[model samples]
Target: MTTVAHTPPSGTRHTVADDIAGVCEAARTHRAYGEEHSTLHPQVWEALRSSPLPRAALPKHCGGLEWGAPHIVEAVRVVAAADPSAGWAAAIHAPAGAFLARLDPPLAKELCPPSETAVAAPVIGGSSVPAGTTAPAGDRMRLQGRWPLVTSAPQLTLAALAARTEEGTRWWLVPGTELRVEDDWDAVGLRGSASHSVSCDTLVPAGHSVCLTDPARIDGALYRFPLYGLMAACIAAVAEATAERALEAFAALAQTARPRHATGSLAHLPAAQEHYAAASARLSAASAFMREAAGQAWHDAVRGQVENAARARLRAAGAHLAATSAEVCQSVFEAAGAAGLYRSSPLEGCWRDAAVASRHALVAAHGRRLAGAQMLTGSAGGHL
Candidate 1:
């Protein structure tokens, strides 16, 4: 499952897809192991480590590819099509580099040194919720709190946690070793994400904290892109790709699967054909909408004028994609009949993954409501 490093030559254009092309097969081959063990397979993890996806969103100076939102979403889709859990982990960890840009240049560079190895793009995991508290401790800060749903916790090199301080809610960059990881992620779907809870009660350098309200030190459109919109789009991309894979699995199953009490294969049934057609069309439309929305936001960000309207559109599209993808997966599952109910069935896994992904707060009803409020009243009264 090991893949040769595919770092492009200087002055040559390379894509996230090209960088991760070799890992897709490994992802497919080890998906079951991850699902069974509740963590990414070691081979797949090694392949990913060799790839540049972990630092795709980082600035070039920071030893990253600095990919745009649309590109990142496409990469996530590609990986998810191979394995939904892998895709979920990629989506969760890929954009973390942006958080590092909030720190001062020296500290940011020190934490993410320029290297020709995976250490340059360390795997990061944390929650945005202010579930912890921080206090001034002379020359340092004492941070204490428990954050849940820390994806890729077991492999994180650095953690980006949010805690409330006297100033306000700020993000802290604590070494993974300082946190106590609790292996408690037992979700039915995305079982391999390793999204366990992490708690920290250690003193960190005073310079480790960053107030998101402050302007970003890095100068780039990728850094300017709306954080919430980017996260929502990434999650939606996973759901969309998972649904697409489910449809493909159902199509393969229909070719040889015979319906009970029927003389012909499942593909011969008009109902099954209709369901497949409808699901495929819906998924295609949803995927297109998601790309368009993310692209528009990125364009605005590049121009240094990301309007609230653009953010609203992206958020709304993300929510729509999540809902549509879940529906499409369910439709494909139903069309597969009892054949899709087995635990080994890929369609069943897609259905479960989509169901769980749709429940994510970023792409939930609340986001859609906020988007609608902004579009109608010109004021969301909250972050879009």
Candidate 2:
């Protein structure tokens, strides 16, 4: 089910359409295997690096699509719908596109050579947070830190990390040769994310590093994209997919579902009908909003029409819509009742995956509120 990225149009013409469709189809294969592919199947991780979605959303200047968050919004939803773990993989791919591309052109060139594959697992390891950096040497940063909860740390070739200093905030690009992976990404749902701990004690060459919060203003719109927005949109998108699967399953159940001591089938029940209908409506709404919002942001970013304020608005909207969509999709599971509780049904997986995925720190109660609060306070969402 793996495929290459479609050739992009001269500007932002028509390539994203085909690229998104392909990401949707490819993620399904990973979804089919779910967590089994994590420790058991290294091939799944390998496929992800070579997959189109990661490359599709990359920075255009650095051999990437430069689609901004909109690109992520479309693809992540499809991937999450198939597998939450895979969705996370794609979510961070934007970092590869955004931060990685911002490195000195030659550094970017060295980090990911033309014929070689590169992996990045970021851990901000200051106390419990993945927030520390290696001391800067003459040309290379002398790496000496360990970041836990790094996804794919076990296999990553590079580490994208942020560290605070006396002067300002900084980020760097370190090689896997400088890292040590510690198996720590053990979770209930996205266990396959390969999110673990990593230790580094090597030098990150000057050409391969950049201070994301440096004096220079980097113009990659994807860097301006919101983590919460990207994460939420992906969940919302998956919810839409799950809703579709649930509806189809519910429809079949409607024709044949029968309960004891009941006069007619579950579908005949007014309550069941209402709940299913509502769930379906929510699913459709979420998908539509996701598409519209994502498309608008990406298109605007490419055209230089969206500034930080506009981008924040889009991020806030994406987070809210994603949160609402998750809620709506959960209703479908409720409507499905005990029969829809089949262990193997896609509905069940959708419920668990969406619930756990939505619970990401970015979309949590506080983070969601913060986004709204930022908008009201005239503050940009987090950092630019």
Candidate 3:
């Protein structure tokens, strides 16, 4: 398998922002192909694999960037703005590296060696919800199950799948090559994410599994951040960025599109102007709230003082962002009139992508309910 070099040449430093820019450029260059083909563009995947964005949440000891939550959120935002599909993939796969910290040091180091030539930390993809069953087999576990909605399934080197054991639910780290990838994803939006179903009926060593509720062996601020919270924030960023792109596309269309029986172009219509202004304001407010929540959570993580209230706020902000962004996209699509109905229109694609993103488990209405329950009763039923 080919691997992307994580280290730059001698004396040439590559910042996280630079890597993010490169990924964004690649996403723009191949967005159309990915959208049409219903799979991630190879070049876009390569660019993302080589970039530090995927390693932003990894531990520094594992040669990861270990970026703060706010930075990670911003990186997803920029990439999503360039192409919503690429951004969705990034949001799903970026936090995967942090899971390695839960494994024993020896196995973690072996899987992701701390060397310049080692493959960029493997993109781990799988569902957290348990859909499989596991049984004890000597020093290993006999695993059999199928997980759905696995983003970038074909590209993943490892899968972090959850399975129900005799004891309880446990996460297993299985090699992607050992799993059967079913090309079953045919979603209307995020077509390029390759969120297919993966099934495996094989034995996995005991060392490859971890109970996520346990403390991570390798301690760090990034690892300290709540996994669900981070996932929600990243998902929210993609939704907000996609909405921003939709608004931009609408602006461009308004400048030239003349509605059927209108006095002038769409831009001159009072109703169109009102819709654009309202959508823009909604997006701006949602973006600010997301950033503020992410920043505060990161601040608490750095000090090793993260509170339940902070996590709840961050999750709430993410849910709010997803809902608001989807609303903004809907408003823009409606205001674009017949122009947005065409497949060639970027606004149309944005609307579709936002509609799908808003349905993600982390950013959906359930997330808000979880946050509200936590805030109101100081208990989320241990869901988070």
Highest lDDT: give the candidate number. Answer: 1
* Model 3 TM-score relative to the real fold: 0.93
lDDT of 1 by residue, 158-245 (tens): 8989998787888899988888999999998988888999999999888987765455688889878887788888899889888888
Candidate 1 TM-score, C-alpha based = 0.92
Report, for every candidate in turn, its global Cα lDDT versus the true structure.
0.83, 0.57, 0.82
What are the per-residue Cα lDDT tens digits for candidate 3 across 161-261?
Answer: 99887767878888888889998888989888888999999898888887765567877787777778888888988898889889889999999999999
Q: Give the deviation of candidate 3 from the true structure as CA RMSD.
A: 4.0
Best by TM-score: 3
Model 2: weakest 10-residue lDDT segment is 119-128
Ordered by TM-score, highest first, the candidates read: 3, 1, 2
Candidate 1 residue 194 Cα shift, in angstroms, is 0.8
- Tell me the lDDT of model 3 at 304: 88
Question: What is candidate 3's CA lDDT for residue 348?
Answer: 82
Q: List clashing residue pairs in candidate 3.
A: none
Reference-based TM-score of each model:
0.92, 0.78, 0.93
